[model samples]
Target: MPLFRLDASIMPATSQSRALADLVESEWSAENPGAAVVRRDIGSEPLSATIWREAVTGGFAAEADRSPAQRTALARAAELADELIEADAVLLAIPLYNWGVPAHVKTWYDLTYTDPRIAGGALNDKPVVLASVLGGNYNPGTPKDGWDHATPWLTRVFRDVWGADLRVVQRQFTLVGVDPAMDRFADQAAEIKAAAEQLAIEHGRAIATQVQSLAA
Candidate 1:
């Protein structure tokens, strides 16, 4: 059975981003029965700053000491990387903040991608799908909304560093104000939520199907 990792970093349950993440998880569960679904709530377990410091220091001996905090950080990073390595597919539910990914999500990426062994080895050839929820209308060729810098950086990290095939399935500009709302505001929100969930299921099935084909 394939493993599906859902990364939810948003603080509020009511947050559109968090909602989308939950929706994706639900869809994956429904479509991939008997599959292992691991939900990594980064908001609940924030990445330790000590790890960030150690990551920047680049000192082998410092990391070798295995200070309690450093050890925890290393362990978490290793666990997350191992999970990614074992999974046939990855889905990142990202919400735009200040025109970029949330800080917690970025930290998650930093932790998972910085490990030289995992990034350079087992993570290669994995397939990733990015599901983004944006408050404003942002796409290519618009003044207010253009290519998200975070998307390209993420693409490079997975492709260049991990040698993974990353496909972006974006649900862009779901905010009601930017686009025309339905008769009722709640109705529009529901429509957007449903669409996002459908995309997530489709993405999950696509990855599973691809993996099966490759195995065959």
Candidate 2:
């Protein structure tokens, strides 16, 4: 079985989201070793704004009638679509940047949306692990309550639009050491992070069992 992992963290080694995702991969691999893992780092390599225009133009025009730019755009769309369509389980690891989903993630969705091969029901209820890391808390009663725009938009895209079966593992209050302004909540950050990591490991185990079942 193939596992598709989409990592949208700007930070490399120190990225909490990516670290959690790696745990997931490791747990899943332990269950079924040698499974192929496909990695896509959208933060480092983002889809250009021009891809949208190309995808749109290519979508409207026939293959033979498409311009070189349009063809390239369509090809890019296909690349993304095939990743999800071919995966047994998907790990969508992302960081909430400025209370919003990363620009590359949105652009990726836009590009895939225009492609003909990847339709509304393309994923067919594929299991998706939504591992999200947020710098600040957005839970109810918090100062930034109801301020999260990233997870919601992703919910619409992964659940409503693509019909994926999503399991979200979110870590909030993550700006403990980075932003001096959030120094007050620094004390609780370690505990919160540990809990999230444990949860991610559990979900990863569940995913491994689920994927193996599907293959059986």
Candidate 3:
């Protein structure tokens, strides 16, 4: 199956999430050689906030009375929806930031609603892989336990609202070598990082397996 990947990290070249996503994409590409890997980097070139506003406001306006801006917004919404609807499965690589969802990530979904296919649930059964990265550990018993608000929300949007079969792979303690304060945990962080990379490769294979199983 063709792969659709979305990267939502502001650090285009150096994002941990993107690096993990690269493993999945690389495996998927190997499995389905020459297949198109459709991608959109919302972190760097996000859909405008204005586009989302126009889409929402234009929804209430009469079709014939809508302004040119509304028309443009509607057009863009359709384009985004097509990307989702056309894909058999998708991989969304996002990072938890400031304990919440990134603005660009939220915007992507809010605009997804503007398209009837998504809002009306026309595209409800595709499988999805959520590959997320976080700066610090928030696992159970950690001080920051339950502090993550992004993963659960993303889960709802894809699995519940959009009805996509979903799987998640997360890499935490990503700030180990970056922040000076976490230097003490550096050794443990390296171990976690290695494990995360191995998991990424497995998850990538898992997607290909799932898609092939569906075909069978």
Q: Score each candidate by Cα lDDT.
A: 0.65, 0.87, 0.87
Which 10 consecutive residues of model 1 have the lowest summed lDDT?
Answer: 177-186
Listed in order, each prediction's TM-score against the native is 0.77, 0.95, 0.95
lDDT of 1 by residue, 1-216 (tens): 465555554555555655555555555556567778656667667676457555534434465565666566666777888778778777676667777766877777777766666757666677777666666555556666564666667677777777777666556556665445522455645666577677766776677666667777
Q: Global CA lDDT of candidate 3, please?
A: 0.87
CA deviation > 4 Å runs, candidate 3: none
**Predictions: Cα RMSD each:** 3.8, 1.3, 1.3
lDDT of 2: 0.87
What is the RMSD of candidate 1?
3.8
- Point out the higher-scoring one by TM-score: 1 or 3: 3
TM-score: which candidate is best? 2
- For model 3, what is the error of residue 122's alpha carbon versus the real structure, in angstroms, after optimal superposition? 3.6
Clashing pairs in 1: none
